[model samples]
Target: MLKLFYTPHTSALATRIVLEEVGAKYEITLIDFEKNEQCSPEYLKINPRGRVPSLVTDSGVLTETPALLVYLAQLFPQSRLAPIDDPYLFAEVQSFNSFICSNLHVAHSHRMRGHRWADEPAAIEAMKRKVPQTVKVAFEQVERHLLRGPWVLGEQYTVSDAYLFTMAQWMEADGVDPSSFPKVLDHRNRMSLRPAVRSALRQELGDQ
Candidate 1:
């Protein structure tokens, strides 16, 4: 069985969502950030970075949500969470995946995990202030890339689309208006309607 060390509302949520979509049997180890369990020696042994998401497979441990998403999609190609039929489509999906996980995700980290980069309170505040502008610009670009709406790569719902949805949910909290990007908002709404997303959010958020 696969094991995933995860925390609710973190990028790990993207993995949980993809796993559900792929119908993969995986166990989740909830890392309690509030209690500093992620920093414990046992957890650190698996993921040196102390990140919330660490995918333990029979072959090897996979860290990074975007990579895990692609792995899961490829593992269960029947889910069609990613394109295997055409290299061009697959490349496009991977491209969006990189932007969401590496680019926009880091921008949001400025708001919540500013200490990772800066110690001064003023510097942290500056990062926090940058969130709205950065997020807005990123989503505007995301909006522009919307091929025909309903998903990141148009009609087909892929693992990368799930990733985009996960990150887009952070827009409001970052002080960016989702309404400003009609296409992105519409895509996010479509994602919200999927059973996979609903299940992931329910499990991650609990009764709240």
Candidate 2:
């Protein structure tokens, strides 16, 4: 059995969605940010980075959304969540996920987590103010070139889709109108219709 540590409304939701997509027998542990439970000594032992979406496997532990999503897809290849058989296509999946993590996710984080990059109040505020434009530019690239239609990587609905859907959920909060990017917005809508995605959202957001 796999155990996933996560917080709602975070990128952790992507990991949870993948877990459901793979139909894995897993349990989830919530790390409440409000209570500072993520910084607790007990949680620190599980994930020293003090972040959400830490997966405890029989072999060991895995952190980072891209890694976790790929791990789950590879663990259950029958689910076809990734192109595990084709090395080139698999790398494409990885590349898409990397961009989301390194670019989009980081841009979104600046809205509230500017302290991660700056100490001066002015610098932090500057980053916060720039989030809308930066995020819009990042998604423009995704919508125009990276997104590849019906799903993130073409006809297949891979882990990349789940990752993108997770970040797209933050568009409004980042002050970027999601409707501006038709392809990305449509992809997000399709993702929301997936049973796995629906289950994950229900688990995290409840009846709201």
Candidate 3:
């Protein structure tokens, strides 16, 4: 069986969604990231960076969100989460995945870690301004490319959509305007409508 270390309301939720979508049997071990559980020695042994969503597979321990997603997709090719045959489409998926990790995730992390960024009021205020601006551009590009979708990658659902959908939910929680990105909004809705997604969210909420 596969073991997943994760946290609620985090990128781990996205990994859970992908696992469910692929019908892969896995056990969830919650890590309280906010409580600093991730930085604990035990968890850090599992994942040196002490991040949630580390997958313990037979092959090895897989860390990082996109890398884990791609690994799982390759492990279960029949799930069609990635394009194994089309190099171009695979590149496209990788491109979007990178955009989310580097652009979207990084900006949000900066905002979340604003205090650590500086003690000066001016520096903190500057981060408050710049982080949102960075996120705005990344999301705008996402909004532009999302085309008439239930998914970011078109008709078929992929890990890319799972990541982006979760991020969109974060954006909503952050008071970001989703109305401007109609396609992304619709994508989020479609993802929410998935039974597996519902299951994942319910589990994350400890609904049983």
Candidate 4:
């Protein structure tokens, strides 16, 4: 069985979402950030960076949500989470993947640790102002792509949409307007309505 170490409301949510979509049997090991379990030596050995997401599979240990998603998609091509045997589709998957990673994910990381970015009060102040702008731009780009339909890639609910939906959860706290991006709002709603997403959310939360 595959074992995934993760915390809720983190990028690890993306991995959980994908695993649910693929119908892959796996065990989730919760890592409590509040308890500092992620920083422990055992967890550190799996991921030296102390990240919340680390997948231990029969093949090997996989870290990083995007890498794991792509890996799993390829491993189970019939799931249609990602493209296989087609260079163009692979390029598109990677292209959109980078957009989310660099823009949305990185900006969220900054917001999660803005104070640590600088010792002085002034640097923290600057980060607080800039991070929102960065996130907004990324959100706008996502809105543009999602305008096509209920999915980022148009008609296919792939890993790209999963990533977008997971990160868009921050909109409420970050003050990013999903209303302005109507398509994105709809897309998020559509994703939320999926049985797989609901099941995964419940399982991860242990809400029997």
Tens digits of per-residue lDDT for model 1, 1-208: 9999988778888889999998889998889898899999999999999997899999999999878998998899998888878999888888888888777898888999999999999999999999999878777778886435667777788888788888888888999998898888888888899898999998987722
Error of 3 at 203 (Å): 0.3
Between candidates 3 and 4, which one is better according to lDDT?
A: 3
How accurate locally, in lDDT, is each candidate?
A: 0.86, 0.93, 0.83, 0.81
Q: Candidate 1: global Cα-lDDT?
A: 0.86
CA deviation > 4 Å runs, candidate 2: none
Which segments of candidate 3 are over 4 A away from where they belong? 115-122, 146-148
Candidate that scores best on TM-score: 2
Q: Over the stretch 1-208, how does candidate 3's per-residue lDDT look in tens digits? A: 9999988877888889999999999998888866899889999899997877899999889998998888888999999999968999888888888888888887876666676668988887777777657777888888876443767777877889889988888775554788878888888888899988998998888922
Better of 1 and 3 by lDDT: 1
Candidate 4 C-alpha error for residue 173, in Å: 0.7
Q: Which stretches of candidate 1 lie over 4 Å from their true place?
A: 146-148
Q: Model 2: which residue pairs collide?
A: none
lDDT of 2 at 151: 95
The lowest-lDDT stretch of 10 consecutive residues in candidate 4 is 144-153
Candidate 2 residues 138-207, lDDT tens each?
9999999999989988999899999999999999999999999999999999999999999999988761
Give the candidates in order of lDDT, highest first.
Answer: 2, 1, 3, 4
Q: Between 1 and 4, whose lDDT is larger?
A: 1
Best-to-worst order by TM-score is 2, 1, 4, 3
Give the best candidate by lDDT.
Answer: 2
TM-score of each: 0.95, 0.97, 0.91, 0.92
For model 4 the local lDDT of residue 23 reads: 90
